[model samples]
Target: MSQERRNFDKEFKLMTVELSKSRESIQELAKELGIRAELIYRWRPEYLEKPEGSFTGHGKPRHTPEEAEIARLKKQLRDVEMERDILKKGHQHLLQGRREIYRFIACQSSRFPVDKMCEVLKVSRSGYYSSLKGTVSKRAKENQELLSLIKQEHKKSRQRYGSPRISQALRANQVQVSRPRVARLMKQAQIKARMVKRFRVSTDSK
Candidate 1:
Protein backbone atom coordinates (compact mmCIF):
# COMPACT_ATOMS: atom_id res chain seq x y z
CA MET A 1 0.00 0.00 0.00
CA SER A 2 1.30 3.48 -0.98
CA GLN A 3 0.50 6.63 1.01
CA GLU A 4 -0.85 9.62 -0.94
CA ARG A 5 1.01 12.95 -0.96
CA ARG A 6 -0.35 15.68 1.34
CA ASN A 7 -1.64 18.78 -0.43
CA PHE A 8 -1.49 22.19 1.29
CA ASP A 9 -4.06 24.96 0.61
CA LYS A 10 -3.35 28.40 -0.96
CA GLU A 11 -3.51 30.12 2.42
CA PHE A 12 -0.92 27.74 3.82
CA LYS A 13 1.40 28.44 0.89
CA LEU A 14 0.96 32.21 1.27
CA MET A 15 1.62 32.00 5.04
CA THR A 16 4.76 29.94 4.44
CA VAL A 17 5.98 32.58 1.99
CA GLU A 18 5.36 35.27 4.61
CA LEU A 19 7.32 33.36 7.24
CA SER A 20 10.33 33.21 4.89
CA LYS A 21 10.63 37.02 5.14
CA SER A 22 11.96 36.59 8.69
CA ARG A 23 15.62 36.10 9.64
CA GLU A 24 14.99 32.38 10.05
CA SER A 25 16.72 30.29 7.39
CA ILE A 26 14.68 28.41 4.79
CA GLN A 27 16.09 25.06 6.01
CA GLU A 28 14.97 25.89 9.56
CA LEU A 29 11.44 26.79 8.45
CA ALA A 30 11.24 23.68 6.29
CA LYS A 31 12.27 21.49 9.23
CA GLU A 32 9.68 23.16 11.49
CA LEU A 33 6.93 22.81 8.85
CA GLY A 34 7.83 19.16 8.10
CA ILE A 35 8.27 19.95 4.42
CA ARG A 36 11.17 20.11 1.95
CA ALA A 37 13.16 23.39 1.91
CA GLU A 38 12.96 23.62 -1.88
CA LEU A 39 9.17 23.83 -1.71
CA ILE A 40 9.37 27.03 0.33
CA TYR A 41 11.90 28.54 -2.09
CA ARG A 42 9.75 27.58 -5.08
CA TRP A 43 6.54 29.01 -3.63
CA ARG A 44 8.13 32.28 -2.38
CA PRO A 45 8.64 34.01 -5.75
CA GLU A 46 5.29 32.91 -7.16
CA TYR A 47 3.34 34.08 -4.13
CA LEU A 48 5.38 37.29 -3.85
CA GLU A 49 4.90 38.10 -7.54
CA LYS A 50 1.13 37.67 -7.48
CA PRO A 51 -0.21 37.29 -3.95
CA GLU A 52 -3.91 37.12 -4.90
CA GLY A 53 -3.55 35.33 -8.20
CA SER A 54 -0.96 32.77 -7.06
CA PHE A 55 -1.96 29.29 -5.88
CA THR A 56 -5.61 29.76 -7.02
CA GLY A 57 -5.58 26.04 -7.81
CA HIS A 58 -3.29 23.49 -9.36
CA GLY A 59 0.36 24.88 -9.91
CA LYS A 60 -0.68 27.71 -12.25
CA PRO A 61 0.47 31.33 -11.54
CA ARG A 62 -1.46 34.25 -13.05
CA HIS A 63 1.10 37.02 -13.55
CA THR A 64 1.28 40.05 -15.89
CA PRO A 65 4.46 40.80 -17.90
CA GLU A 66 5.50 43.50 -15.41
CA GLU A 67 4.93 41.17 -12.47
CA ALA A 68 6.96 38.47 -14.19
CA GLU A 69 9.86 40.93 -14.68
CA ILE A 70 9.61 42.02 -11.06
CA ALA A 71 9.76 38.39 -9.89
CA ARG A 72 12.82 37.80 -12.10
CA LEU A 73 14.56 40.84 -10.63
CA LYS A 74 13.77 39.71 -7.10
CA LYS A 75 15.29 36.31 -7.83
CA GLN A 76 18.38 38.03 -9.26
CA LEU A 77 18.67 40.16 -6.13
CA ARG A 78 18.52 37.07 -3.94
CA ASP A 79 21.27 35.49 -6.06
CA VAL A 80 23.44 38.58 -5.60
CA GLU A 81 22.90 38.56 -1.86
CA MET A 82 23.98 34.93 -1.70
CA GLU A 83 27.14 35.76 -3.61
CA ARG A 84 27.94 38.68 -1.31
CA ASP A 85 27.52 36.51 1.78
CA ILE A 86 29.94 33.99 0.33
CA LEU A 87 32.49 36.70 -0.52
CA LYS A 88 32.15 38.20 2.97
CA LYS A 89 33.03 34.82 4.48
CA GLY A 90 36.30 34.65 2.48
CA HIS A 91 37.50 38.18 1.75
CA GLN A 92 41.33 38.55 1.92
CA HIS A 93 43.44 35.96 3.75
CA LEU A 94 46.29 37.71 5.64
CA LEU A 95 48.59 35.37 7.58
CA GLN A 96 51.11 37.48 9.54
CA GLY A 97 48.90 40.19 10.99
CA ARG A 98 48.29 41.73 14.43
CA ARG A 99 46.38 39.53 16.88
CA GLU A 100 44.76 42.63 18.46
CA ILE A 101 43.07 43.46 15.17
CA TYR A 102 41.71 39.93 15.03
CA ARG A 103 40.54 40.25 18.64
CA PHE A 104 38.72 43.50 17.81
CA ILE A 105 37.04 41.82 14.86
CA ALA A 106 36.19 38.79 17.01
CA CYS A 107 34.54 41.08 19.56
CA GLN A 108 32.16 42.19 16.79
CA SER A 109 31.50 38.61 15.62
CA SER A 110 28.04 38.63 17.22
CA ARG A 111 27.14 41.46 14.79
CA PHE A 112 29.46 40.16 12.05
CA PRO A 113 30.33 36.53 11.35
CA VAL A 114 33.62 35.16 12.77
CA ASP A 115 34.29 33.33 9.51
CA LYS A 116 34.21 36.67 7.71
CA MET A 117 36.88 38.10 10.04
CA CYS A 118 38.94 34.94 9.83
CA GLU A 119 38.92 35.26 6.03
CA VAL A 120 39.57 38.99 5.93
CA LEU A 121 42.30 38.86 8.58
CA LYS A 122 44.05 35.91 6.87
CA VAL A 123 43.60 33.79 9.99
CA SER A 124 42.16 30.32 9.99
CA ARG A 125 38.83 29.82 11.75
CA SER A 126 40.59 27.40 14.08
CA GLY A 127 43.35 29.97 14.63
CA TYR A 128 40.75 32.63 15.39
CA TYR A 129 39.15 30.30 17.95
CA SER A 130 42.55 29.59 19.49
CA SER A 131 43.38 33.31 19.60
CA LEU A 132 40.12 33.92 21.51
CA LYS A 133 41.12 31.23 24.01
CA GLY A 134 44.56 32.81 24.45
CA THR A 135 45.59 35.60 26.83
CA VAL A 136 45.10 39.31 26.08
CA SER A 137 47.60 41.11 23.79
CA LYS A 138 50.48 43.17 25.22
CA ARG A 139 49.02 46.48 23.91
CA ALA A 140 45.64 45.73 25.52
CA LYS A 141 47.43 44.83 28.73
CA GLU A 142 49.31 48.17 28.70
CA ASN A 143 46.05 50.02 27.92
CA GLN A 144 44.47 48.45 31.01
CA GLU A 145 47.45 49.52 33.13
CA LEU A 146 47.31 53.08 31.74
CA LEU A 147 43.54 53.20 32.24
CA SER A 148 43.95 52.17 35.89
CA LEU A 149 46.61 54.86 36.44
CA ILE A 150 44.39 57.36 34.64
CA LYS A 151 41.46 56.49 36.93
CA GLN A 152 43.62 56.86 40.01
CA GLU A 153 44.93 60.25 38.86
CA HIS A 154 41.46 61.32 37.73
CA LYS A 155 39.99 60.59 41.17
CA LYS A 156 43.00 62.14 43.04
CA SER A 157 42.35 65.43 41.24
CA ARG A 158 38.62 65.11 41.99
CA GLN A 159 38.12 64.32 38.26
CA ARG A 160 39.34 67.76 37.24
CA TYR A 161 42.18 66.61 34.99
CA GLY A 162 41.49 66.06 31.30
CA SER A 163 44.02 64.34 28.95
CA PRO A 164 46.62 67.17 28.82
CA ARG A 165 47.00 67.52 32.60
CA ILE A 166 46.75 63.78 33.05
CA SER A 167 49.64 63.29 30.60
CA GLN A 168 51.88 65.63 32.62
CA ALA A 169 50.95 63.81 35.84
CA LEU A 170 51.77 60.43 34.28
CA ARG A 171 55.14 61.89 33.09
CA ALA A 172 55.88 63.16 36.62
CA ASN A 173 55.74 59.53 37.74
CA GLN A 174 58.03 58.63 34.74
CA VAL A 175 55.11 57.04 32.87
CA GLN A 176 56.24 58.74 29.57
CA VAL A 177 52.96 58.38 27.62
CA SER A 178 51.32 60.59 24.99
CA ARG A 179 48.39 62.86 25.90
CA PRO A 180 46.37 61.81 22.85
CA ARG A 181 46.92 58.14 23.69
CA VAL A 182 45.80 58.86 27.26
CA ALA A 183 42.75 60.67 25.91
CA ARG A 184 41.81 57.75 23.64
CA LEU A 185 42.10 55.29 26.51
CA MET A 186 40.13 57.62 28.77
CA LYS A 187 37.40 57.80 26.15
CA GLN A 188 37.33 54.02 25.90
CA ALA A 189 37.22 53.73 29.71
CA GLN A 190 34.43 56.34 29.78
CA ILE A 191 36.43 58.65 32.00
CA LYS A 192 35.36 62.29 31.88
CA ALA A 193 36.86 65.26 33.74
CA ARG A 194 34.56 66.87 36.26
CA MET A 195 33.68 70.44 35.31
CA VAL A 196 34.35 72.88 38.16
CA LYS A 197 31.92 75.78 38.48
CA ARG A 198 33.19 79.20 39.59
CA PHE A 199 31.68 80.67 42.75
CA ARG A 200 29.68 83.87 42.17
CA VAL A 201 28.79 86.33 44.94
CA SER A 202 25.51 88.29 44.82
CA THR A 203 24.82 91.32 47.09
CA ASP A 204 21.49 93.16 47.50
CA SER A 205 21.38 96.70 49.12
CA LYS A 206 18.13 98.41 50.05
Candidate 2:
Protein backbone atom coordinates (compact mmCIF):
# COMPACT_ATOMS: atom_id res chain seq x y z
CA MET A 1 0.00 0.00 0.00
CA SER A 2 1.21 3.62 -0.91
CA GLN A 3 1.11 6.47 1.75
CA GLU A 4 -0.60 9.82 0.78
CA ARG A 5 1.31 13.16 1.10
CA ARG A 6 0.31 15.62 3.89
CA ASN A 7 0.47 19.48 3.51
CA PHE A 8 1.18 21.65 6.60
CA ASP A 9 0.33 25.40 6.83
CA LYS A 10 2.80 28.08 7.95
CA GLU A 11 1.31 28.17 11.49
CA PHE A 12 1.53 24.39 11.89
CA LYS A 13 5.15 24.38 10.70
CA LEU A 14 6.05 27.24 13.11
CA MET A 15 4.43 25.46 16.09
CA THR A 16 6.24 22.25 15.22
CA VAL A 17 9.61 24.05 15.14
CA GLU A 18 8.93 25.85 18.49
CA LEU A 19 7.93 22.58 20.17
CA SER A 20 11.10 20.92 18.84
CA LYS A 21 13.12 23.65 20.70
CA SER A 22 11.91 22.25 24.05
CA ARG A 23 13.88 19.62 26.03
CA GLU A 24 11.61 17.00 24.39
CA SER A 25 13.28 15.14 21.54
CA ILE A 26 12.23 15.96 17.96
CA GLN A 27 10.98 12.40 17.45
CA GLU A 28 8.83 12.68 20.57
CA LEU A 29 7.23 16.03 19.51
CA ALA A 30 6.71 14.81 15.92
CA LYS A 31 5.09 11.64 17.27
CA GLU A 32 2.79 13.74 19.51
CA LEU A 33 1.92 16.16 16.62
CA GLY A 34 1.51 13.15 14.18
CA ILE A 35 4.05 14.76 11.77
CA ARG A 36 7.21 13.17 10.43
CA ALA A 37 10.43 14.19 12.25
CA GLU A 38 12.31 14.74 8.94
CA LEU A 39 9.67 17.25 7.78
CA ILE A 40 9.93 19.22 11.04
CA TYR A 41 13.74 19.40 10.67
CA ARG A 42 13.38 20.72 7.11
CA TRP A 43 10.90 23.52 8.18
CA ARG A 44 13.14 24.70 11.05
CA PRO A 45 15.98 25.94 8.77
CA GLU A 46 13.52 27.85 6.52
CA TYR A 47 12.00 29.64 9.57
CA LEU A 48 15.49 30.53 10.94
CA GLU A 49 16.61 31.92 7.57
CA LYS A 50 13.87 34.63 7.58
CA PRO A 51 11.96 34.70 10.88
CA GLU A 52 10.15 38.01 10.18
CA GLY A 53 8.17 36.77 7.15
CA SER A 54 8.42 33.03 7.76
CA PHE A 55 5.00 32.56 9.42
CA THR A 56 3.09 35.07 7.23
CA GLY A 57 0.29 33.42 5.23
CA HIS A 58 0.38 33.25 1.42
CA GLY A 59 -0.41 36.32 -0.85
CA LYS A 60 0.20 38.96 1.88
CA PRO A 61 3.38 41.06 1.78
CA ARG A 62 4.92 42.19 5.10
CA HIS A 63 4.71 45.97 5.56
CA THR A 64 8.13 47.63 5.47
CA PRO A 65 8.94 50.49 7.91
CA GLU A 66 9.22 53.07 5.12
CA GLU A 67 5.81 52.17 3.65
CA ALA A 68 4.17 52.44 7.09
CA GLU A 69 5.67 55.92 7.66
CA ILE A 70 4.47 57.14 4.27
CA ALA A 71 0.90 55.90 4.98
CA ARG A 72 0.83 57.77 8.33
CA LEU A 73 2.04 61.06 6.80
CA LYS A 74 -0.52 60.83 3.97
CA LYS A 75 -3.35 60.41 6.47
CA GLN A 76 -2.16 63.45 8.49
CA LEU A 77 -1.98 65.66 5.41
CA ARG A 78 -5.50 64.63 4.31
CA ASP A 79 -6.95 65.52 7.72
CA VAL A 80 -5.31 68.99 7.75
CA GLU A 81 -6.53 69.82 4.23
CA MET A 82 -10.05 68.67 5.06
CA GLU A 83 -10.23 70.97 8.08
CA ARG A 84 -8.91 73.88 6.04
CA ASP A 85 -11.63 73.44 3.40
CA ILE A 86 -14.38 73.12 6.01
CA LEU A 87 -13.36 76.42 7.58
CA LYS A 88 -13.47 78.19 4.21
CA LYS A 89 -17.27 78.12 3.77
CA GLY A 90 -18.96 81.43 2.90
CA HIS A 91 -22.33 80.29 4.31
CA GLN A 92 -23.82 81.27 7.65
CA HIS A 93 -23.49 77.75 9.04
CA LEU A 94 -20.35 78.53 10.98
CA LEU A 95 -20.29 78.85 14.75
CA GLN A 96 -22.05 81.95 16.18
CA GLY A 97 -23.69 82.43 12.74
CA ARG A 98 -23.30 85.43 10.44
CA ARG A 99 -24.01 87.95 13.20
CA GLU A 100 -20.67 87.23 14.91
CA ILE A 101 -18.73 86.33 11.77
CA TYR A 102 -15.56 88.07 12.90
CA ARG A 103 -15.77 86.40 16.30
CA PHE A 104 -16.03 82.96 14.72
CA ILE A 105 -13.16 83.74 12.34
CA ALA A 106 -10.97 84.86 15.24
CA CYS A 107 -11.63 81.59 17.07
CA GLN A 108 -10.93 79.35 14.06
CA SER A 109 -7.96 81.37 12.74
CA SER A 110 -5.59 79.70 15.24
CA ARG A 111 -5.89 76.40 13.37
CA PHE A 112 -6.87 77.35 9.80
CA PRO A 113 -5.70 80.18 7.52
CA VAL A 114 -6.82 83.66 8.65
CA ASP A 115 -7.08 84.94 5.05
CA LYS A 116 -9.39 82.08 4.16
CA MET A 117 -11.53 82.81 7.20
CA CYS A 118 -11.77 86.50 6.37
CA GLU A 119 -12.65 85.80 2.74
CA VAL A 120 -15.26 83.20 3.65
CA LEU A 121 -16.80 85.38 6.35
CA LYS A 122 -17.03 88.36 3.92
CA VAL A 123 -14.80 90.54 6.13
CA SER A 124 -11.91 92.69 4.95
CA ARG A 125 -8.52 91.12 5.70
CA SER A 126 -7.21 94.55 6.64
CA GLY A 127 -9.85 94.86 9.36
CA TYR A 128 -8.82 91.55 10.83
CA TYR A 129 -5.18 92.71 10.79
CA SER A 130 -6.16 95.98 12.45
CA SER A 131 -8.06 94.08 15.13
CA LEU A 132 -4.97 91.97 15.76
CA LYS A 133 -3.00 95.21 16.15
CA GLY A 134 -5.33 96.21 19.07
CA THR A 135 -7.48 98.62 17.04
CA VAL A 136 -11.09 98.50 18.23
CA SER A 137 -14.13 98.68 15.90
CA LYS A 138 -16.19 101.87 15.68
CA ARG A 139 -18.96 100.47 17.90
CA ALA A 140 -16.45 99.17 20.44
CA LYS A 141 -14.64 102.53 20.49
CA GLU A 142 -17.92 104.38 21.00
CA ASN A 143 -18.87 102.03 23.81
CA GLN A 144 -15.57 102.69 25.56
CA GLU A 145 -16.12 106.44 25.41
CA LEU A 146 -19.67 106.05 26.66
CA LEU A 147 -18.47 103.83 29.52
CA SER A 148 -15.97 106.50 30.62
CA LEU A 149 -18.72 109.11 30.64
CA ILE A 150 -21.05 106.81 32.56
CA LYS A 151 -18.35 106.18 35.18
CA GLN A 152 -17.75 109.91 35.60
CA GLU A 153 -21.46 110.70 35.89
CA HIS A 154 -22.00 107.90 38.39
CA LYS A 155 -19.13 109.20 40.51
CA LYS A 156 -20.41 112.85 40.35
CA SER A 157 -23.84 111.69 41.58
CA ARG A 158 -22.20 110.01 44.59
CA GLN A 159 -22.86 106.55 43.14
CA ARG A 160 -26.61 107.24 43.26
CA TYR A 161 -27.22 107.11 39.46
CA GLY A 162 -29.10 104.12 38.03
CA SER A 163 -29.58 103.30 34.34
CA PRO A 164 -32.48 105.79 33.95
CA ARG A 165 -30.55 108.64 35.57
CA ILE A 166 -27.43 107.75 33.66
CA SER A 167 -29.35 107.85 30.41
CA GLN A 168 -30.82 111.24 31.38
CA ALA A 169 -27.38 112.57 32.23
CA LEU A 170 -25.93 111.32 28.95
CA ARG A 171 -28.73 112.99 26.97
CA ALA A 172 -28.29 116.16 28.99
CA ASN A 173 -24.67 116.26 27.84
CA GLN A 174 -25.88 115.91 24.19
CA VAL A 175 -24.54 112.29 24.03
CA GLN A 176 -27.58 110.66 22.48
CA VAL A 177 -28.07 106.98 23.41
CA SER A 178 -30.95 104.76 24.44
CA ARG A 179 -31.73 103.96 28.10
CA PRO A 180 -31.69 100.18 27.52
CA ARG A 181 -28.31 100.44 25.79
CA VAL A 182 -26.91 102.23 28.82
CA ALA A 183 -28.34 99.52 31.10
CA ARG A 184 -26.82 96.77 28.93
CA LEU A 185 -23.42 98.46 28.91
CA MET A 186 -23.52 98.99 32.66
CA LYS A 187 -24.42 95.35 33.18
CA GLN A 188 -21.49 94.23 31.00
CA ALA A 189 -19.10 96.57 32.86
CA GLN A 190 -20.40 95.28 36.22
CA ILE A 191 -21.04 98.87 37.31
CA LYS A 192 -23.82 99.33 39.84
CA ALA A 193 -24.84 102.62 41.46
CA ARG A 194 -25.38 102.78 45.19
CA MET A 195 -29.10 102.85 46.11
CA VAL A 196 -30.11 105.64 48.51
CA LYS A 197 -32.12 104.31 51.42
CA ARG A 198 -34.80 106.47 53.07
CA PHE A 199 -34.10 107.46 56.70
CA ARG A 200 -36.71 106.14 59.17
CA VAL A 201 -37.06 107.77 62.60
CA SER A 202 -39.64 106.59 65.18
CA THR A 203 -40.91 109.04 67.86
CA ASP A 204 -41.63 107.18 71.17
CA SER A 205 -43.59 108.57 74.13
CA LYS A 206 -41.24 109.36 77.08
Candidate 3:
Protein backbone atom coordinates (compact mmCIF):
# COMPACT_ATOMS: atom_id res chain seq x y z
CA MET A 1 0.00 0.00 0.00
CA SER A 2 1.13 3.55 -0.82
CA GLN A 3 1.20 5.96 2.10
CA GLU A 4 -0.01 9.52 1.83
CA ARG A 5 2.54 12.32 2.00
CA ARG A 6 2.60 14.63 5.06
CA ASN A 7 2.59 18.38 4.78
CA PHE A 8 3.78 20.95 7.35
CA ASP A 9 2.77 24.57 7.50
CA LYS A 10 5.15 27.50 7.11
CA GLU A 11 5.34 28.26 10.86
CA PHE A 12 6.48 24.72 11.76
CA LYS A 13 9.08 24.68 8.98
CA LEU A 14 10.44 28.05 10.07
CA MET A 15 10.53 26.97 13.71
CA THR A 16 12.42 23.79 12.75
CA VAL A 17 14.94 25.79 10.77
CA GLU A 18 15.48 28.18 13.68
CA LEU A 19 15.95 25.24 16.07
CA SER A 20 18.44 23.73 13.64
CA LYS A 21 20.59 26.86 13.98
CA SER A 22 20.86 26.42 17.77
CA ARG A 23 21.30 22.64 17.83
CA GLU A 24 24.63 20.82 17.53
CA SER A 25 23.33 18.62 14.74
CA ILE A 26 20.28 18.79 12.48
CA GLN A 27 20.29 14.98 12.35
CA GLU A 28 19.79 14.77 16.11
CA LEU A 29 17.04 17.38 15.99
CA ALA A 30 15.32 15.59 13.12
CA LYS A 31 15.42 12.30 15.04
CA GLU A 32 13.93 13.98 18.10
CA LEU A 33 11.19 15.66 15.99
CA GLY A 34 10.53 12.44 14.04
CA ILE A 35 11.25 14.12 10.69
CA ARG A 36 13.81 13.38 8.02
CA ALA A 37 17.11 15.28 8.36
CA GLU A 38 17.09 15.97 4.62
CA LEU A 39 13.89 17.99 4.99
CA ILE A 40 15.57 20.34 7.50
CA TYR A 41 18.70 20.64 5.34
CA ARG A 42 16.51 21.52 2.35
CA TRP A 43 14.43 24.07 4.26
CA ARG A 44 17.41 25.82 5.92
CA PRO A 45 18.69 27.65 2.82
CA GLU A 46 15.24 28.78 1.69
CA TYR A 47 14.39 29.97 5.17
CA LEU A 48 17.70 31.85 5.42
CA GLU A 49 17.67 33.53 1.96
CA LYS A 50 13.97 34.46 1.87
CA PRO A 51 12.02 33.37 4.96
CA GLU A 52 8.98 35.49 4.00
CA GLY A 53 8.51 33.74 0.67
CA SER A 54 10.11 30.37 1.40
CA PHE A 55 7.12 28.17 2.23
CA THR A 56 4.23 29.92 0.50
CA GLY A 57 2.36 27.40 -1.65
CA HIS A 58 0.32 28.38 -4.75
CA GLY A 59 -2.42 30.95 -4.02
CA LYS A 60 -0.92 31.71 -0.60
CA PRO A 61 -0.20 35.35 0.23
CA ARG A 62 3.42 36.32 0.86
CA HIS A 63 4.33 37.74 4.26
CA THR A 64 4.74 41.51 4.55
CA PRO A 65 7.92 43.11 5.91
CA GLU A 66 6.11 44.00 9.14
CA GLU A 67 4.97 40.40 9.52
CA ALA A 68 8.52 39.17 8.94
CA GLU A 69 9.78 41.59 11.61
CA ILE A 70 7.17 40.33 14.03
CA ALA A 71 8.23 36.73 13.35
CA ARG A 72 11.84 37.64 14.01
CA LEU A 73 10.89 39.33 17.26
CA LYS A 74 8.94 36.24 18.29
CA LYS A 75 11.95 34.04 17.67
CA GLN A 76 14.14 36.35 19.75
CA LEU A 77 11.53 36.32 22.50
CA ARG A 78 11.49 32.51 22.51
CA ASP A 79 15.27 32.34 22.86
CA VAL A 80 15.18 34.81 25.76
CA GLU A 81 12.44 32.81 27.47
CA MET A 82 14.46 29.60 27.12
CA GLU A 83 17.53 31.21 28.69
CA ARG A 84 15.39 32.64 31.45
CA ASP A 85 14.02 29.20 32.20
CA ILE A 86 17.48 27.68 32.36
CA LEU A 87 18.56 30.33 34.85
CA LYS A 88 15.44 29.90 36.96
CA LYS A 89 15.84 26.15 37.12
CA GLY A 90 19.60 26.22 37.73
CA HIS A 91 19.59 28.89 40.43
CA GLN A 92 19.35 26.42 43.30
CA HIS A 93 22.39 24.51 42.06
CA LEU A 94 24.37 27.73 42.07
CA LEU A 95 23.78 28.00 45.82
CA GLN A 96 24.52 24.31 46.36
CA GLY A 97 27.98 23.80 44.83
CA ARG A 98 30.05 24.24 41.71
CA ARG A 99 29.89 20.52 40.95
CA GLU A 100 26.14 20.63 41.32
CA ILE A 101 25.98 23.54 38.90
CA TYR A 102 28.14 21.63 36.44
CA ARG A 103 25.83 18.62 36.78
CA PHE A 104 22.80 20.82 36.12
CA ILE A 105 24.44 22.25 33.01
CA ALA A 106 25.29 18.77 31.78
CA CYS A 107 21.74 17.52 32.35
CA GLN A 108 20.35 20.43 30.34
CA SER A 109 23.09 20.52 27.67
CA SER A 110 20.89 18.90 25.02
CA ARG A 111 18.16 21.51 25.54
CA PHE A 112 20.30 24.61 26.12
CA PRO A 113 23.74 25.69 24.92
CA VAL A 114 26.58 24.89 27.36
CA ASP A 115 28.19 28.30 26.88
CA LYS A 116 24.91 30.00 27.64
CA MET A 117 24.41 27.86 30.74
CA CYS A 118 27.90 28.61 31.99
CA GLU A 119 27.37 32.32 31.42
CA VAL A 120 24.00 32.28 33.13
CA LEU A 121 25.24 30.13 35.99
CA LYS A 122 28.39 32.24 36.43
CA VAL A 123 30.63 29.19 36.01
CA SER A 124 33.79 29.03 33.95
CA ARG A 125 33.57 27.12 30.67
CA SER A 126 36.96 25.54 31.38
CA GLY A 127 35.72 24.30 34.75
CA TYR A 128 32.66 22.77 33.13
CA TYR A 129 34.75 21.03 30.46
CA SER A 130 37.20 19.88 33.10
CA SER A 131 34.37 18.32 35.06
CA LEU A 132 33.34 16.44 31.90
CA LYS A 133 36.86 15.13 31.56
CA GLY A 134 36.46 13.83 35.12
CA THR A 135 39.94 14.60 36.50
CA VAL A 136 39.41 12.34 39.50
CA SER A 137 41.45 13.04 42.58
CA LYS A 138 43.42 10.44 44.56
CA ARG A 139 40.82 10.53 47.34
CA ALA A 140 37.98 9.98 44.86
CA LYS A 141 39.73 6.97 43.34
CA GLU A 142 40.30 5.50 46.80
CA ASN A 143 36.65 6.05 47.73
CA GLN A 144 35.53 4.28 44.56
CA GLU A 145 37.62 1.24 45.41
CA LEU A 146 36.31 1.32 48.98
CA LEU A 147 32.76 1.58 47.68
CA SER A 148 33.30 -1.52 45.54
CA LEU A 149 34.59 -3.46 48.55
CA ILE A 150 31.64 -2.15 50.59
CA LYS A 151 29.22 -3.44 47.98
CA GLN A 152 30.86 -6.85 47.94
CA GLU A 153 30.82 -7.15 51.72
CA HIS A 154 27.25 -5.87 51.75
CA LYS A 155 26.10 -8.57 49.34
CA LYS A 156 28.13 -11.35 51.02
CA SER A 157 26.28 -10.66 54.23
CA ARG A 158 22.95 -11.06 52.41
CA GLN A 159 21.88 -7.52 53.39
CA ARG A 160 21.95 -8.50 57.07
CA TYR A 161 25.03 -6.49 58.02
CA GLY A 162 25.01 -2.79 58.75
CA SER A 163 27.93 -0.39 58.49
CA PRO A 164 29.37 -1.48 61.87
CA ARG A 165 29.67 -5.11 60.90
CA ILE A 166 30.91 -4.20 57.41
CA SER A 167 33.56 -1.98 58.98
CA GLN A 168 34.69 -4.79 61.28
CA ALA A 169 34.86 -7.22 58.35
CA LEU A 170 37.00 -4.82 56.33
CA ARG A 171 39.26 -4.12 59.31
CA ALA A 172 39.72 -7.86 59.80
CA ASN A 173 40.97 -8.07 56.23
CA GLN A 174 43.62 -5.36 56.99
CA VAL A 175 41.52 -2.57 55.47
CA GLN A 176 41.94 0.63 57.52
CA VAL A 177 38.42 2.12 57.26
CA SER A 178 36.34 3.68 60.00
CA ARG A 179 32.74 2.81 60.79
CA PRO A 180 31.57 6.38 60.12
CA ARG A 181 33.16 6.42 56.66
CA VAL A 182 31.59 3.05 55.87
CA ALA A 183 28.20 4.37 57.00
CA ARG A 184 28.52 7.46 54.85
CA LEU A 185 29.49 5.46 51.77
CA MET A 186 26.69 2.97 52.42
CA LYS A 187 24.17 5.80 52.67
CA GLN A 188 25.43 7.27 49.41
CA ALA A 189 25.06 3.89 47.73
CA GLN A 190 21.60 3.36 49.28
CA ILE A 191 22.84 0.06 50.66
CA LYS A 192 20.96 -0.18 53.90
CA ALA A 193 21.07 -3.27 56.08
CA ARG A 194 17.77 -5.16 56.16
CA MET A 195 16.21 -5.32 59.60
CA VAL A 196 14.86 -8.60 60.89
CA LYS A 197 11.73 -8.56 63.01
CA ARG A 198 11.82 -10.24 66.38
CA PHE A 199 9.53 -13.24 66.91
CA ARG A 200 7.25 -13.25 69.97
CA VAL A 201 4.49 -15.63 71.08
CA SER A 202 1.34 -14.45 72.89
CA THR A 203 -0.19 -16.77 75.50
CA ASP A 204 -3.86 -16.62 76.57
CA SER A 205 -4.84 -17.96 80.08
CA LYS A 206 -8.45 -18.92 80.76
Most accurate candidate by lDDT: 3
Pairs of colliding residues, candidate 1? 93-122, 94-122
lDDT of each: 0.79, 0.77, 0.89
Q: Write the per-residue lDDT of candidate 2 for residues 1-206, one digit (tens) a residue.
A: 99897666777777788877873688888888897889877778767877767656541335579978998999999866755575555345554534366666676677767776666556788887776687777898898899999999989999899999999999999999999999989998998989788999999999
TM-score of each: 0.45, 0.46, 0.44
Runs in model 1 deviating more than 4 A are 1-83, 86-117, 121-127, 202-206
Q: What number of backbone clashes does candidate 3 have, counting pairs of residues 3 or more apart or in separate chains?
A: 0
Superposed model 2: Cα runs more than 4 Å off: 1-107, 119-124, 203-206
Q: Among all windows of ten consecutive residues in candidate 2, which has the lowest summed lDDT?
A: 90-99
Q: Predicted candidate 3: what Cα RMSD to the true structure?
A: 15.5
Positional deviation of residue 138's Cα in model 2 after best superposition, in angstroms:
2.8
**Model 3 bad stretches (over 4 Å):** 1-87, 94-99, 107-125, 200-206
Candidate 1 per-residue lDDT, tens place, 1-206, comes to 99778788888888888889993689999999999899998999887777778987665777779989999999999766754654464343233245655655665677666765555455678766766788566787898899999999999999999999999999999998999999999987889999999999999998
| Model 2: lDDT to the true structure | 0.77
Cα lDDT, model 3, residue 8: 85
> What tens-digit string does per-residue lDDT give for candidate 3 at 67-155?
98999999999879988999789988988768899999999999899998998888999989988999775777898999999999989
